[model samples]
Target: MAGHDLDRSLGLYPTMMISMGAMIGSGIFVLPALGYKKAGPAVILAYLVAAAVVLPAALSKAEMATAMPESGGTYLYIDRALGPLFGTIAGIGAWFSLVFKSSFALVGLGAYLLLFAPISQGAVVYVALALAVLVVALNVSGTKMSGQIQAVIVTLVVAGLLAYVVNAGFVADAGRYAPFTTHGGSGIITAAAFVFVSYAGVTKIASVAEEVKDPGKNLPRAMLGSMAIMTLLYIGVVGAIIGLSDPEVLKTGGPGGTASLTPMADGAGALLGGAGVLFISVIAVVALTSMANAGVLSSSRFPLAMSRDDLLPSSLQTIDARFKTPRNAVLLTGVVLLLLIAFVPVIELAKLASAFQILVFSFENMALVAFRVADVPSYEPEFKAPGYPFVQVFGFVAGIALLTQMGTVPILGAVGIILGSALVYVAYGRPRTDRTGAIGTILRARRGEEDDGIAATEPE
Candidate 1:
């Protein structure tokens, strides 16, 4: 594989914040409402199912990230354990997922902006694209700046959740959430399947393994910690919404349904006063900005990966010697994200992204198994999955189950991605540099001592 450079300015704290920032975004404030629309009051069960699937997946990624301790997150895992073909496929699948999800974040941005700006309300399309552009610009500057922005965004996320928990967790009526199963069992399960996309960003933490400190420890902690935090917040926020409203009112695909968080927040206001709605609105806006912040940070690394591998034009891998950042790659990432804003909806993009990521994650789990079975002596993972193969097995099954639940469109979407990647491989997967460890290892060795230390090389 052709070698390329990336800045190492991102560290454990910043990277963890990046992952946390990404995971906490629209999934908390936005997807819950979308899930409510899909399954009504029974959405609580959906949260459980989503968390069940994603927790294991996160653990699986933690294991793989520790083993690889390099860039490309799961992409490196698959390349080493499986082969270059599978790795390339995994990379494409994951990259596509991030792209789609980032665009969906912009959709939320547009929706939230419309709520506050009358002009934005009239120009939702333009505003969504504009938010995408703005976020892209922020990320393109450099990883250090991105981390600082994410720090601010993550703070707002915490404050927003704090607001919701205080008023709704304490003051809301309980009877409104009655029976809890009002949305039907299967519907709740389906909604959970959809909401799994909320957890998608958690694995993105592993993408910058080399840039982090004490990665094996901190990455796992951040992965599991953020998941727990978000899960609790989700339960609280959704609990508040349900506690304050009749399921039938927030209900959708039925007789009387408003089917948005707005209705739920309005009900909270009725019970807790207008201050409750104000609280929800403020959090909602913060959620929008933070979600965008998350989207831009992790995604800019992809073009760097592809360029370094020669899968994309080499220009993308260029690093500014002064800043040590891949400005070209960041710009390309933004342009692609911007183009996606016009066409996709949050739920649709969420489903598609979920399917794509599930495929990559499943392979990553399998990679753990493959590496152990192959006994490749050069690699000894610092953090291994507890139960070794069993946890990975559980993760694999969970991914399959979620994919099954996605029905036809998502499944086909995943299949199409793999097939498209295969076609690309047939054409461009040459020199087999895209191969497992051979070319990448060879290139890194050749550049040893000739490098400025900015080259992305695995340490022997």
Candidate 2:
């Protein structure tokens, strides 16, 4: 067998689901408490600031995506616009960032469950890892299966969020925000910087361009749709949280998104009475699952793209003969995610993921400007960033500022990873492709598998 093709079952709803699930994660509920401490009441400012920064970035991504609709998202855009080397490093970094982010998403899932199922040894990690594996299995099954699952999960997630927002009451305590700059201007800015990750999910739309139905329309629609909806929900939640209690009080409560959203349940219980927390707790679980599924859908594609380009082993590039999904890549992603949840600290990973993506986003934003200026052809994406060089540049600088605000360890670590990736590129990066080359053949086989279904057709 020599060649194959991907099953194109994903449509606009699935595309929007991918983006929605990716953005409205357990973090919004989980992180608010943390921001309460960091920025006091002013954390709201951070949320708005983060939203402002991401708006431009989203628009910029839309512009580039309209021109180049591929699986790798920014990785594909940068490589096509910049060149193989810049593209390779960017793609690797972007892929790694998602893997790390997915790892935390898994951790968040298990950790949230522990609130109700706390004391079981290895239960949390095991359960989360298992969920991740389930996602991989789903993807390997077929696009239709994956699409349905994603859409359902995303729907429940949105419903749960809207429930809390609408039911959480209107009057936010002006006192909690009294000392708006209580954490100092820098503190609120820092807290908001962290919250910025909540909006990063919108980029997931750009990551699966090849499989999206009518990418030109769906891509932009999904990007803008998810962004607008998630933003409204987020603003509502933040408003509800502040109205319910003081941010300073929340800061002292717990860690994780579940910790943050639990207050909403408490607020609801006080107003609605009895089992309120339990009701929202269930919502929390659904939200966590949604995040993991969408994440798995996105992260798996990273390795698939890398393998296709000969930067990684072609085995990872393999798709199921019948499913038209990247079987090996999905499995590999599951393995990496499991390892991260098992070993790494969640907060640290969040910071790292956020910082690294900020760097990648900065590049993407810059690429938007460069491509616009260079005037490359064939990108022809459905959406464009609007405001051209100015907005993209502004977003780029803001992202860089966030990276700096993330402090020394994360910033330095991100830089180090980029360097290490470069070194890897110097070493195993450019494996030559030839008919006799095993690696090259494997990569081609993967490409072929993506072309055909499970049954490999003999070369005609």
Candidate 3:
């Protein structure tokens, strides 16, 4: 088990579905009203803005993944490029971001379940935790099994969303766009910052790069392809909601304001009546489940990769002999997610998740630039990101800008977490590890000394 590796069993379609599934969860189902509350009908622009910012990060991640083609996604790239300290932040940050996002999806799942059956809030929490356990179990079984489930869930979710969008379009009222920026440019930017979590899934596919067949081609295709599709889906969904429902009605909250809680369902109900509510509810279940499944599959890899690097307990790196999956890592991720779902407030968790992801994206952009400037011979990637440093520079800048818009609490929370991670790395991780990452190689090269094992070349 210690020597085993994840099987390269996922193909292009499953990989793409994994990305789509991770993204199209509670964000689309529940975040519309939140976005609208922040920017009214201009929330569509928020989605677009978020996508634009995420694009360069996506391409940068793809290029890095092609060069590394390993697990841990952003964690591995940042570790290799910036060294272990930043890598520690990225590893912990990526873990918590995905866990919180998955917890959000599970909580949303509980809410959707209540529509079908009356249940106490405690019961809902229990049910959500139970479902998270199930998702982890499926992931621990095998990546192929998880990928198959994701493909099915993504198909159902996309079809339901398309139906809702089309139905709402036929009955659209353009008047909702009257006060586009009710909260002003700052509001729109803030909303974009929050909803930016929706696009975080695009890079998640890279976490499983070790298990992706022909990762050089498939990784970039899956990341970019899913990002493109989800962008269109989000924009269309937001447009349909704004067109089919009154902004004031969408903004209402409470038990009576289920519309605000589930905007897509409300829009569908407005277009097709009660049956549409049931339809969208079904989509909600599938969408949230897909997200939880994909989240567990991807997030578990961070701990696995860290353990392999001796940054974490060696137990976490244990691969199940039969399934070829990191069972311990999957269990740990599931347990943490269950705790978050049961204990943390959903809104704060969502905000922090978005904030941490932005930080991770910023680091990824920096990693790409660092590696390119370092010009390590092993840094050769089959699929280079188009536009070079410009794209990465823009991504880095945009990510920081969005981070600033998240307000004080999440910003402070992220800083504290980063500081805490750095402390842990110095006290525990640094002494155990001897490998100097890409940055160390640069320093050694500057001194005309042998730079570890990888040969270095002058920047092209």
Candidate 4:
């Protein structure tokens, strides 16, 4: 592959913060109320279930990122393991999924904004758009500045959440535990699907692996470490919110139903009084806007990775000489984020983003399987995912099961994305290059060939 030409400025600390910042945003702050609406107080179980489902993909990605350590995390792995066609789908889907989730976080800023002032929904949209612009500019400048911002925001938010969890645990009403499983198994599983995107940001660090220092050691450490930290944090925060907040507000959540924006602020007000309200509101806004910033930084790499492989226009691969950032790719992502913030409703944004994320995750697991089965000599990962084929297979099955429970629109949307990506490959990407991946090894081995032809097409 062509060199990414990006600076290796992110260290272990900054890298971990980026992954944590991305994972802790909208999922914890906004979506718990919606999950509560579906699964009752059992939304705590839904968070647990969602974390369980996300674990395998996180493991798989850690393993792959260690071996590859390149830009376009999901896209690069899929392209090298499956082939360019599927790479196109993974690249586009991963990009849109991150963008959609980021936009959702920005839109959610309105709910917390309501606590500080009585702003109209239209005004909230404008605020979100403004934040999007700032995030895009931060990314265009350089990854170092972007990672620094994420580190500050994630550290402060995590501290606030830890304090809230501990304080709320002391005063939480025992009565809230009386009716935990109101909707039963089906409801909890469905709620899990809705909240699954909460953990989507855990794997985003892989996309910019090319820009990380000592990626072989730091990539696995950051991704796996963030996954473990966020899972516990998610469960604890959601449990506190359920125990402290009123059932009625969680159920209705304004006009948006399950997409209620300010569960953290509302629950904080109840648990710690007015002081708690102000504290959590500030943290929520900072946490979510930081997430959007990380999203811009990571998602922009997909276009750059694909363009380097001739899957997109070469212009996107242009790195700024001074800043060493993908300026065009960041700007492209910004335009899409602006349009999404302006046109889409909150619920649709969350559901669609979760759906696309699950699809990309399924492909990630399969790519790992392909690499192991092919057993390419160069495919050595310092950190291997435990359970081997079973873990990958289970991740794939769980992803499909959760997708089915996400309702009809998201299911259709995932299918449309696959078909659309295929069309783009056949029409625009096919004639540009002849590339093959690990699958070529498997096919050649079946014919008893001395060596596979993958080296001929793969870029250096």
Each candidate's lDDT (Cα)?
Answer: 0.67, 0.67, 0.80, 0.82
Tens-digit lDDT track for model 3 on 1-460?
A: 2446767888888888878877888778877777888888889989989989988888888777767755567888888888888889999998888888888788778767776776543456677788887888888888565456667778888988888888888888888788778999999999898898888877767656667888767877788788888989998998998887766667874133433655776556676665887888888987787777777877898998888887888899998999888889998998888788778766667788888989989899998888888788778876688888898999999999989988897899789879988988888888987656777777887899976635322111
**lDDT (tens digit, per residue) of candidate 1 on 1-460:** 7456454556556766766676776666556666776676678778777877776667666766666656666666666566666766887787778777777666666665565555523365587788877787766665454556658867776776767666766767777665666458767877887777777777767666556566657766777777777777777777777776655555541112324434335455654456665666666667666666655666666657765676666887898786677788777777777766666544567678778877877877777776666454565666666667787888788788778877788899898988888777667765545354433443444667332221222322
Tens digit of per-residue lDDT, candidate 2, span 248-293: 3465444433234244443545333455567766777777666666
Clashes of each: 0, 21, 0, 3
Please identify model 3 stretches exceeding 4 Å from their true place: 1-18, 119-126, 137-149, 205-225, 246-249, 252-259, 320-325, 453-460
* Model 4 Cα lDDT, one tens digit per residue, 287-323: 8776777678778988999998989999999999988
lDDT pick, better of 3 and 4? 4
Model 3 local distance difference test score:
0.80
lDDT, candidate 4, at 138: 88
Model 1, residue pairs in steric clash: none
The candidate with the higher lDDT, 1 or 3, is 3
How well does candidate 4 match the true structure, expressed as C-alpha RMSD? 3.2
Error of 4 at 252 (Å): 2.3
Choose the strongest candidate by lDDT.
Answer: 4
